[model samples]
Target: MNPINKVSQARVMSPILSGLIYAFVIMFAGTLFTSLILLLTSANESNLPAFSYINHIISLLVGGWVAGKKSGTKGWYYGGMLGCIYTLIIFMIAFLSFDAGLNGRSFLLLCVSLLSAGIGGIFGVNSRK
Candidate 1:
Protein backbone atom coordinates (compact mmCIF):
# COMPACT_ATOMS: atom_id res chain seq x y z
CA MET A 1 0.00 0.00 0.00
CA ASN A 2 1.12 3.55 -0.67
CA PRO A 3 2.41 5.54 2.32
CA ILE A 4 -0.28 8.19 1.89
CA ASN A 5 -2.99 5.53 1.62
CA LYS A 6 -1.64 3.76 4.70
CA VAL A 7 -1.69 6.99 6.70
CA SER A 8 -5.24 7.72 5.62
CA GLN A 9 -6.35 4.26 6.66
CA ALA A 10 -5.13 4.71 10.23
CA ARG A 11 -7.88 5.19 12.79
CA VAL A 12 -7.93 8.58 14.42
CA MET A 13 -9.84 9.25 17.58
CA SER A 14 -11.88 12.38 17.98
CA PRO A 15 -10.20 15.17 19.89
CA ILE A 16 -13.07 15.44 22.37
CA LEU A 17 -12.86 11.75 23.21
CA SER A 18 -9.12 12.03 23.64
CA GLY A 19 -9.53 15.04 25.93
CA LEU A 20 -12.18 13.34 28.05
CA ILE A 21 -9.98 10.31 28.57
CA TYR A 22 -7.10 12.51 29.69
CA ALA A 23 -9.38 14.44 32.02
CA PHE A 24 -10.67 11.28 33.67
CA VAL A 25 -7.17 9.90 34.10
CA ILE A 26 -6.00 13.14 35.64
CA MET A 27 -8.97 13.16 38.00
CA PHE A 28 -8.33 9.61 39.11
CA ALA A 29 -4.68 10.31 39.77
CA GLY A 30 -5.48 13.47 41.70
CA THR A 31 -8.03 11.67 43.81
CA LEU A 32 -5.56 8.92 44.63
CA PHE A 33 -2.87 11.44 45.51
CA THR A 34 -5.26 13.39 47.69
CA SER A 35 -6.34 10.26 49.49
CA LEU A 36 -2.73 9.32 50.12
CA ILE A 37 -1.98 12.75 51.52
CA LEU A 38 -4.96 12.61 53.81
CA LEU A 39 -4.01 9.18 55.05
CA LEU A 40 -0.28 9.81 55.50
CA THR A 41 -0.44 13.18 57.20
CA SER A 42 -2.47 14.88 59.85
CA ALA A 43 -3.52 17.46 57.27
CA ASN A 44 -6.63 19.39 58.11
CA GLU A 45 -9.63 17.61 56.69
CA SER A 46 -11.31 20.96 56.17
CA ASN A 47 -9.06 21.57 53.16
CA LEU A 48 -10.29 18.55 51.26
CA PRO A 49 -13.10 20.46 49.60
CA ALA A 50 -10.74 23.12 48.33
CA PHE A 51 -8.31 20.54 47.05
CA SER A 52 -11.03 18.73 45.17
CA TYR A 53 -12.07 21.87 43.37
CA ILE A 54 -8.49 22.62 42.45
CA ASN A 55 -8.02 19.14 41.12
CA HIS A 56 -11.10 19.37 38.93
CA ILE A 57 -9.96 22.69 37.52
CA ILE A 58 -6.53 21.35 36.77
CA SER A 59 -7.92 18.26 35.09
CA LEU A 60 -10.31 20.20 32.88
CA LEU A 61 -7.60 22.69 31.92
CA VAL A 62 -5.24 19.96 30.83
CA GLY A 63 -7.93 18.09 28.99
CA GLY A 64 -8.99 21.20 27.16
CA TRP A 65 -5.42 21.87 26.17
CA VAL A 66 -5.12 18.42 24.71
CA ALA A 67 -8.31 18.80 22.73
CA GLY A 68 -7.30 22.19 21.42
CA LYS A 69 -3.88 20.96 20.40
CA LYS A 70 -5.36 17.99 18.64
CA SER A 71 -7.97 19.95 16.75
CA GLY A 72 -5.41 22.61 15.83
CA THR A 73 -8.21 25.11 15.23
CA LYS A 74 -11.29 26.50 17.04
CA GLY A 75 -9.54 25.70 20.29
CA TRP A 76 -12.02 27.45 22.56
CA TYR A 77 -14.99 25.77 20.94
CA TYR A 78 -13.42 22.32 21.16
CA GLY A 79 -12.36 22.91 24.76
CA GLY A 80 -15.77 24.23 25.76
CA MET A 81 -17.46 21.24 24.17
CA LEU A 82 -15.13 18.92 26.05
CA GLY A 83 -15.86 20.71 29.33
CA CYS A 84 -19.61 20.55 28.75
CA ILE A 85 -19.48 16.87 27.95
CA TYR A 86 -17.27 16.17 30.95
CA THR A 87 -19.63 17.99 33.31
CA LEU A 88 -22.63 16.08 31.97
CA ILE A 89 -20.84 12.78 32.45
CA ILE A 90 -19.86 13.71 35.98
CA PHE A 91 -23.40 14.80 36.77
CA MET A 92 -24.78 11.53 35.57
CA ILE A 93 -22.28 9.54 37.62
CA ALA A 94 -22.96 11.63 40.71
CA PHE A 95 -26.69 11.25 40.30
CA LEU A 96 -26.46 7.52 39.86
CA SER A 97 -23.90 6.82 42.56
CA PHE A 98 -24.57 9.49 45.16
CA ASP A 99 -28.06 10.66 44.30
CA ALA A 100 -26.68 14.13 43.87
CA GLY A 101 -28.95 16.80 42.41
CA LEU A 102 -28.21 19.86 40.38
CA ASN A 103 -27.86 22.95 42.53
CA GLY A 104 -25.99 26.23 42.94
CA ARG A 105 -22.67 24.54 43.57
CA SER A 106 -23.07 22.43 40.47
CA PHE A 107 -23.81 25.49 38.42
CA LEU A 108 -20.69 27.18 39.70
CA LEU A 109 -18.64 24.13 38.88
CA LEU A 110 -20.00 24.06 35.32
CA CYS A 111 -19.09 27.68 34.79
CA VAL A 112 -15.65 27.29 36.22
CA SER A 113 -14.96 24.18 34.24
CA LEU A 114 -16.00 25.86 31.01
CA LEU A 115 -13.84 28.89 31.70
CA SER A 116 -10.81 26.89 32.69
CA ALA A 117 -11.01 24.67 29.64
CA GLY A 118 -11.54 27.61 27.31
CA ILE A 119 -8.48 29.37 28.64
CA GLY A 120 -6.39 26.26 28.32
CA GLY A 121 -7.60 25.76 24.78
CA ILE A 122 -6.59 29.27 23.80
CA PHE A 123 -3.14 28.62 25.14
CA GLY A 124 -2.88 25.29 23.43
CA VAL A 125 -3.72 26.68 19.99
CA ASN A 126 -1.01 29.30 20.26
CA SER A 127 1.60 26.94 21.64
CA ARG A 128 4.41 25.74 19.39
CA LYS A 129 4.76 22.03 18.96
Candidate 2:
Protein backbone atom coordinates (compact mmCIF):
# COMPACT_ATOMS: atom_id res chain seq x y z
CA MET A 1 0.00 0.00 0.00
CA ASN A 2 2.80 2.39 0.92
CA PRO A 3 5.03 3.86 -1.77
CA ILE A 4 8.20 2.34 -0.26
CA ASN A 5 6.70 -1.12 -0.14
CA LYS A 6 5.51 -0.80 -3.70
CA VAL A 7 8.95 0.27 -4.79
CA SER A 8 10.49 -2.75 -3.12
CA GLN A 9 8.06 -5.00 -4.88
CA ALA A 10 8.83 -3.29 -8.16
CA ARG A 11 12.46 -4.20 -7.71
CA VAL A 12 11.43 -7.81 -7.88
CA MET A 13 11.22 -9.22 -11.42
CA SER A 14 7.72 -10.01 -12.54
CA PRO A 15 6.76 -13.64 -12.35
CA ILE A 16 4.70 -13.25 -15.49
CA LEU A 17 7.79 -12.39 -17.52
CA SER A 18 9.72 -15.28 -16.07
CA GLY A 19 6.79 -17.60 -16.64
CA LEU A 20 6.56 -16.63 -20.30
CA ILE A 21 10.26 -17.20 -20.66
CA TYR A 22 9.92 -20.63 -19.17
CA ALA A 23 7.06 -21.38 -21.50
CA PHE A 24 9.27 -20.61 -24.48
CA VAL A 25 11.98 -22.76 -23.04
CA ILE A 26 9.61 -25.65 -22.69
CA MET A 27 8.28 -25.13 -26.17
CA PHE A 28 11.75 -25.21 -27.63
CA ALA A 29 12.61 -28.34 -25.74
CA GLY A 30 9.43 -30.00 -26.88
CA THR A 31 10.11 -29.10 -30.49
CA LEU A 32 13.60 -30.44 -30.31
CA PHE A 33 12.47 -33.67 -28.76
CA THR A 34 9.71 -34.09 -31.30
CA SER A 35 12.07 -33.47 -34.16
CA LEU A 36 14.54 -35.97 -32.85
CA ILE A 37 11.90 -38.60 -32.35
CA LEU A 38 10.43 -38.06 -35.77
CA LEU A 39 13.83 -38.36 -37.36
CA LEU A 40 14.73 -41.51 -35.49
CA THR A 41 11.44 -43.40 -35.57
CA SER A 42 9.32 -44.90 -38.28
CA ALA A 43 6.10 -44.44 -36.38
CA ASN A 44 2.73 -44.02 -38.02
CA GLU A 45 1.44 -40.50 -38.66
CA SER A 46 -1.44 -41.10 -36.30
CA ASN A 47 0.90 -41.86 -33.43
CA LEU A 48 2.83 -38.63 -33.89
CA PRO A 49 -0.17 -36.63 -32.74
CA ALA A 50 -0.44 -38.63 -29.53
CA PHE A 51 3.18 -37.94 -28.74
CA SER A 52 2.71 -34.31 -29.65
CA TYR A 53 -0.19 -33.83 -27.25
CA ILE A 54 1.61 -35.55 -24.40
CA ASN A 55 4.72 -33.43 -24.85
CA HIS A 56 2.62 -30.31 -25.19
CA ILE A 57 1.03 -30.89 -21.81
CA ILE A 58 4.34 -31.74 -20.23
CA SER A 59 5.81 -28.54 -21.60
CA LEU A 60 2.94 -26.59 -20.17
CA LEU A 61 3.49 -28.20 -16.81
CA VAL A 62 7.20 -27.48 -16.82
CA GLY A 63 6.58 -23.90 -17.86
CA GLY A 64 4.12 -23.37 -15.01
CA TRP A 65 6.43 -25.05 -12.54
CA VAL A 66 9.33 -22.81 -13.52
CA ALA A 67 7.12 -19.77 -13.26
CA GLY A 68 5.96 -20.76 -9.80
CA LYS A 69 9.44 -21.57 -8.62
CA LYS A 70 10.79 -18.30 -9.94
CA SER A 71 8.00 -16.29 -8.35
CA GLY A 72 8.60 -17.82 -4.94
CA THR A 73 5.14 -16.66 -3.87
CA LYS A 74 1.52 -17.15 -4.98
CA GLY A 75 2.48 -20.00 -7.25
CA TRP A 76 -1.05 -20.74 -8.38
CA TYR A 77 -1.85 -17.14 -9.09
CA TYR A 78 1.22 -16.60 -11.19
CA GLY A 79 0.89 -19.91 -12.99
CA GLY A 80 -2.79 -19.39 -13.72
CA MET A 81 -2.11 -15.91 -14.95
CA LEU A 82 0.59 -17.26 -17.24
CA GLY A 83 -1.83 -19.87 -18.55
CA CYS A 84 -4.51 -17.30 -19.26
CA ILE A 85 -2.06 -15.14 -21.10
CA TYR A 86 -0.67 -18.04 -23.08
CA THR A 87 -4.08 -19.36 -24.05
CA LEU A 88 -5.33 -15.95 -25.04
CA ILE A 89 -2.39 -15.50 -27.34
CA ILE A 90 -2.94 -18.87 -28.92
CA PHE A 91 -6.62 -18.17 -29.36
CA MET A 92 -5.88 -14.86 -30.94
CA ILE A 93 -3.38 -16.35 -33.34
CA ALA A 94 -5.82 -19.03 -34.37
CA PHE A 95 -8.55 -16.49 -34.89
CA LEU A 96 -6.39 -14.17 -36.91
CA SER A 97 -4.19 -16.52 -38.89
CA PHE A 98 -6.67 -19.05 -40.22
CA ASP A 99 -9.91 -17.28 -39.45
CA ALA A 100 -10.65 -20.07 -37.05
CA GLY A 101 -14.05 -20.00 -35.43
CA LEU A 102 -14.43 -20.12 -31.71
CA ASN A 103 -16.72 -22.57 -29.98
CA GLY A 104 -17.55 -24.04 -26.57
CA ARG A 105 -14.83 -26.61 -26.98
CA SER A 106 -12.22 -23.90 -27.34
CA PHE A 107 -13.45 -22.29 -24.15
CA LEU A 108 -13.22 -25.59 -22.36
CA LEU A 109 -9.67 -25.99 -23.56
CA LEU A 110 -8.77 -22.69 -21.97
CA CYS A 111 -10.16 -23.88 -18.66
CA VAL A 112 -8.09 -27.05 -18.88
CA SER A 113 -4.95 -25.09 -19.67
CA LEU A 114 -5.48 -22.84 -16.66
CA LEU A 115 -6.09 -25.77 -14.38
CA SER A 116 -2.99 -27.59 -15.62
CA ALA A 117 -0.82 -24.56 -15.05
CA GLY A 118 -2.23 -24.04 -11.59
CA ILE A 119 -1.54 -27.65 -10.60
CA GLY A 120 2.00 -27.41 -11.89
CA GLY A 121 2.44 -24.21 -9.92
CA ILE A 122 1.53 -26.00 -6.72
CA PHE A 123 4.18 -28.60 -7.41
CA GLY A 124 6.75 -25.91 -8.15
CA VAL A 125 6.08 -24.19 -4.88
CA ASN A 126 6.36 -27.44 -2.99
CA SER A 127 9.59 -28.52 -4.65
CA ARG A 128 12.86 -28.04 -2.80
CA LYS A 129 15.16 -25.31 -3.93
Q: Relative to the unseen true structure, what is the C-alpha lDDT of residue 119 in candidate 1, on a scale of 0 to 100?
A: 79
In angstroms, how far off is 97's CA in candidate 1? 0.4
What does candidate 2's lDDT look like per residue over 89-124, in tens digits? 768987999898889857765776688788778778
Model 2 Cα displacement at 80 (Å)? Answer: 1.1
The C-alpha stretches of model 2 lying farther than 4 A from their native spots are 1-12, 103-105
Tens digits of per-residue lDDT, candidate 1, 1-129, equal: 645544444438887898899999999999999999999999888989888889889999999988888888888998999889999998999999999999998998899889988877777777736
lDDT of 2 at 109: 59
- What lDDT does each candidate get? 0.88, 0.75
Against the true structure, candidate 1 reaches a TM-score of 0.89
